[model samples]
Target: MRVLIAGAHGQVGHELLRFAPDGCEVVALGSAELDITNAQQVAKVVERLRPQLIINAAAYTAVDKAESEPERAWAVNRDGIAHLAQTAERLGIPIFHISTDYVFAGDASEPYRETDPTGPTGVYGASKLGGELELVANCSEHIILRTSWVFGAHGNNFVKTMLRLGREREELGVVADQRGCPTSAASIARALWALAVQYREHGSLQWGLYHFSGTPACTWHEFALEIFRQAHALSLLERVPLVRAICTADYPTPATRPAWSVLDCAKLRETLGIAQADWREELAQVLRELA
Candidate 1:
């Protein structure tokens, strides 16, 4: 089966290229090669490739900056996805669109489920929600996977930022009030590849919105502490900095983050027989790679 992946240079996209199943033809394209916002280019490329499946990992993911640049966020997150979904539907190909956990209001006491009501608090979340709606409306053969707090060996992520800060400063403040699971891009890539292979073999899919994140939700403060712990163990850090736990009110940002953005992955597990990875294990691997 031929698989075309957009946003090939991103964390999850890069992992997808590395972990994709053998014997499958994979065409990975970064933004410079094929911008999803360009409708004509998307149509032309999809037509030329005629891939059996398309995985869209492209997104405008600057959460804080999105507050100041709503247009750019909407263009890539919503309109760009619309173009891909439309083109995929036209060519009778299935699409796997990556979404975020921000679509929820973060008010839920428990983990957010796939059927939860969406109330995005910021432009980034709203635009991603728009992208989800666009995909649902445009294509029937599409699976929208909503993940949270993604990190990996490649790209700019919270793990990398914390590592850099840990190396530079004596102390750092992390918001303890916010909570979510930290998913590994490698795990997400493997799961998506499994779904793609299943679809190709069976010629059918249980397509719809699903949630998949790492096991054991944690706050930014806790996550930072773990990073320091692992880095220190790996001898990657000369001096482990102090991570002070602070409330969300202590540090203000352009965008308001979800106070509780953990997602329940039971649906994906039940449907696809996929299990969530232990984030601590993944974190150790990531730290070792950095080391």
Candidate 2:
């Protein structure tokens, strides 16, 4: 099958290339190569490639910066996705789009299910939610995968930031109030590829929203401590600095992050017959890659 991956240079996109299923023709493109924001350019590429499946990994993911550049974020995330959905609908091709957990207001006590109401608190989250809605309205054969706390070797993720700060400073302060699962982009890529394969075989199956992430839930502070622990074990860090757990208010940003963005993966696990790996195991793999 022909698979086209947009934002091939991103964290998740890079992992998609690394972990994509074998025996499929994969074409990867970054923003420079195939600008999704430009409808004409997008149409041209889609027309030429004529891919059987399109995986949209491209997105404006500056959570804090989205507050200042809301237009750019909305253009790339929502408008671009709308274009992809419409084009895919026209060509009778399926689209697999990646979304985020920020869509929730983050006040829930338990894990957020697919049916949970989404009232995003930030421009980034709001734009992503808009894209999700557009896909459901415009495209019939579309799969939206909403994930959280994505980290990988290729991009500017929390793991990389923590490692950098842990090496530079004597102390690292991470928010303890914000709770979510740290999903490895490699895992997401693999799961997305599996779902794409399923869609290829059973085109008539229900194609809609699903939540995926690591098994265990953790706060940023805990995740940072784990990163330091693994880094120390791997001899990546010279000395383990004082990792402090602070509240969200202590490190205020322009965007309002969800206090609890944990997503329920029951439907994904049951429907795909897949088991999620523990966060520590996945973290080990990511750290190894970083090393």
Candidate 3:
């Protein structure tokens, strides 16, 4: 099978490249090589490669910055995805695009389900939601995976940022009100590869949006404290600070984040027969690698 991965240099993309699945010829492309926002470039690449599967990991991920740069965010997140989906349709290929839990308004009492209505609080979320709509509309064979709080070995994720900051500061302030799962990019890559293989074997199955993340949910403060604790235990840090809890209003950003962005993984678990790893266990693996 021929698989073409966009944003191959990103956190999840890099991990996917490192953990390339068996029995597949993987062609990875970074933004410099193939700017997804350029429809002509996308069309040219897809036309030449004619890949059976296209897994898009490219995105404009600056959450707070997106508020001031909505156009830029939409270019890559919304319009870029439309281009990929359209090109996939032209080649009669399937696309596996990554999305986010920010599609929800963050007011849900429980985990957000696939069938729930989306009310994005910021431009970033709205752009991703736009991408989802485009993918569903433009292509019949596509998989939209909505995940949250993604972290791993590569990229500027919260896990890495906290590790760096914890070393310099005696105390840290993290937003405690916002609650969601910390999804490992490695796990997300594995799930994407699995879904790609399954789609190849069973083309008749339904193709649409699905939510996947770590099993247990946690606040940003709790997550930070856990990271510091594990880092200290592993000797990765000299001392772990008392990570103070703060509300969303305490530290304001240009983007309005959803208060709760936890996604329900019941459909993903049941349909794919996949189970999510615990958040701490996932974080431990990441830290071990960093160490």
Candidate 4:
């Protein structure tokens, strides 16, 4: 299978490049090389590569900044995806995409299924939802994997932030009210490649929306505690900082974060036999790499 990966320098995209399985021909590009927001470039590139499939890791992911820059967010998140989907539709090829858990309103009491009603509270979520709609409208063969709390050895994520703070401060406060699963970039790459391999063997997929996230939900405070614990054990940090549990109201941002970002990934597991990754184990691997 010949695959083209967008957002090649991003957290997930980088892992997709590193963990690409054998027997697959991969061409990955960063935003500078193939700006999806530019329709002409997208058309030209797809024409040149003629990839069997396109896995789009590109996204405008500045959650708080998106509140002040809705137009920019929509341009990249919605319009950019529309270009990719349309090009894929024209070529009669499949397109796989990454989406966020923020598409749901923060009010859900239980884990959200793929069919759950979406009500985005922030500009970033609204823009991503727009992209999802555009992809569905444009492409017949597509899979949208809505994930949450993605972190990796590369890129700026909550894990890196907590590590930096752990080194700088003796104590810190984290929002305990918010809950979500912390998925690693490598795990997501593995899932996507599994789907790619299945499609290559079968020539088609049971393609649609599916939720893929890490196992066992926890609060940000709890996530931070684990990061410090692991980092200290790995000698990545000299000492573990005290993480104080606090309400969301204590820390304000321009955009409202979804309180419930846990996704029920049973559908993917049952259909594709891809199990939810245990984030604790993934975190250890990441910490070891960082150390």
Candidate 5:
């Protein structure tokens, strides 16, 4: 199978490249090589590579920044995806795209299912939702994986931020009211590969949207405490800083965060046999890599 991975330098994309299975010819490109926002570039690359599958790890992930730069965000998130979907549909190939939990309004009391109502409150989420609609509208053979609280050694994430703050400050405040799964890029890569393998073997997969994220949802403060705990155990941090539990109002950002971003992953587990990874275990592995 000839697989093409966009955003190859990103945390999840890096892992996807690292774990390229045997017998698969992988053509991985960073955003510099294949700018999805450029429709002509996308069509040209798809024609040149002619990959059997296109896995889009590329995205405009700056949540707060998207509020100020909606055009940039939409160009990359929505229009870029539309371009890819068009080319993929032209080639009759499938697309495995990564999405976010931010698509939800964050007001749900329970975990957000795939069928749950989507009401994005900010520009970033709205743009991502637009991308999702474009993909569905353009391509029939596609799989959308929505994840949350992503962290890895290869990119800027909550874990790295907390680790840096742990080393610099005696105390730090993290939003405790906002709860979501802290998924590792590694875990996401594994899940996507599993889907790819399933498709390769069966020649088709149950195509649609699914939620794949870390297990045991936690608040930002709790996640920060865990980060400090793991880093301290691994000797990555000489002194674990005090993590203060604060509400969303304590810290203001250009974008409004979901109060409850937990995604119900039972559909993926039951359908594709992909289970939620323990975020604590994944965090330990990331810490080890950083160390």
Candidate 6:
């Protein structure tokens, strides 16, 4: 089976390349190599590759910056996806797209389900939701996997940011009111590889929207403290900084973040028979890699 991976340089995309299943031919393309936003370019590349499956990891992920660049955000998130869905539908190939948890309003007391109503709070979230809708409407065979708070050894993410601050500062402030699961890119890649293998072997997969994130949701403050703890244990930090918990108002940004965007993965487990990984264990592995 031949698989095409867009956004190959991203955190999850890079991991996908590294963890690609055996006996499968993988063609990974970064934005520079094949920009999804360019419809002609996308069509030409997909036509040339003729991959059996396409995994779209490309996205405009600047949450705060999306407020000032909605057009760019929509172009990459929504328009790019529309192009892929149409092309894949034309070629009779299936697509696996990654989405985010920001599609929710974040006011729910319990975890958000796949059937929950979407009310994106910021331009970034709204654009991603648009992409999901476009993908569903344009393609018949597709898997839209929504996740949250993704981090990894590679890429600019919360974990890397916290590690950098911990090394440079004695004190750091993180939002305590907001809570969500921290998923590892490596885990996501592994899950995608498993799904791809299943599809290749069985010739079909259960399609539709699904949620898959790390187990044990936590606040940014708690995540920061854990990072410091692990970094200290690894001797990667000369001195672990004091992580101060603060409300959303204490640290303002251009985008309004979800106060509680935890997603329930029961559907994923029940339908796909996939289990959620312990985030702490994944964090330890990432720390080891960084060290």
Worst 10 residues of 5 by lDDT: 15-24
- In model 4, the Cα lDDT at residue 141 comes to 100
In candidate 4, what are the lDDT values of residues 1-291, reduced to their tens digit?
899999989999999998999999999999999999999999999999999999999999999999999999999999999999999999998999999999999799899999899999999999999999999999999999999999999999999999999999999999999999999999999999999999999999999999999988999999999999999988999999889999999999999999988899999999988899999999999988887
Question: Candidate 2 lDDT, tens digit per residue, 180-274?
Answer: 99999888998888887776677654678999999799999999999999999998899999998899999989998999989999988887754
- For candidate 4, list the clashing residue pairs, or say none: none
Indicate whether candidate 1 or candidate 2 has the larger lDDT: 1
Misplaced by over 4 Å in model 5 are none
Of the two candidates 2 and 6, the one with more favorable TM-score, higher being better, is: 6
Candidates 2 and 3: which is better by lDDT? Answer: 3
Q: Could you tell me the lDDT of residue 187 within candidate 4?
A: 96
Superposed on all Cα atoms, model 6 deviates from the true structure by an RMSD in Å of 0.6
**Local error of candidate 5 at 109, Å?**
0.9
What's the lDDT for residue 286 in model 1?
A: 84
Alpha-carbon lDDT, every model: 0.94, 0.90, 0.91, 0.95, 0.95, 0.95
State the weakest 10-residue window (summed lDDT) of model 1.
282-291
TM per prediction: 0.99, 0.98, 0.98, 0.99, 0.99, 0.99
Pairs with steric clashes in candidate 1: none
Model 6, span 1-291: residue lDDT tens: 999999999999999999997898999999998899999999999999999999999999999999998999999999999999999999999999999999999999899999999999999999999999999999999999999999999999999999999988999789999999999999999988888998998999999999999989999999999999998999989888988999999999999999998999998899888788889999999999999
lDDT of 4: 0.95
As a whole number from 0 to 100, the lDDT of residue 31 in candidate 3 is: 98
For the record, the alpha-carbon RMSD of candidate 5 to the native fold, in angstroms, is 0.6
Off by over 4 Å in 6: none
Give candidate 4 regions above 4 Å deviation: none
Candidate 3 C-alpha lDDT tens digits along 1-291: 899999999999998887777888999999999899999999999999988899999999999999998999999999999999999998899898999999889999888999999999899999999999999999999888999999997889999999999999998799999999999999899888888778778864457889999868999999999999999999999998878899999998888878898899999889886678687988899999999
User: In candidate 6, how many clashes are counted?
Assistant: 0
True-structure lDDT of candidate 3: 0.91
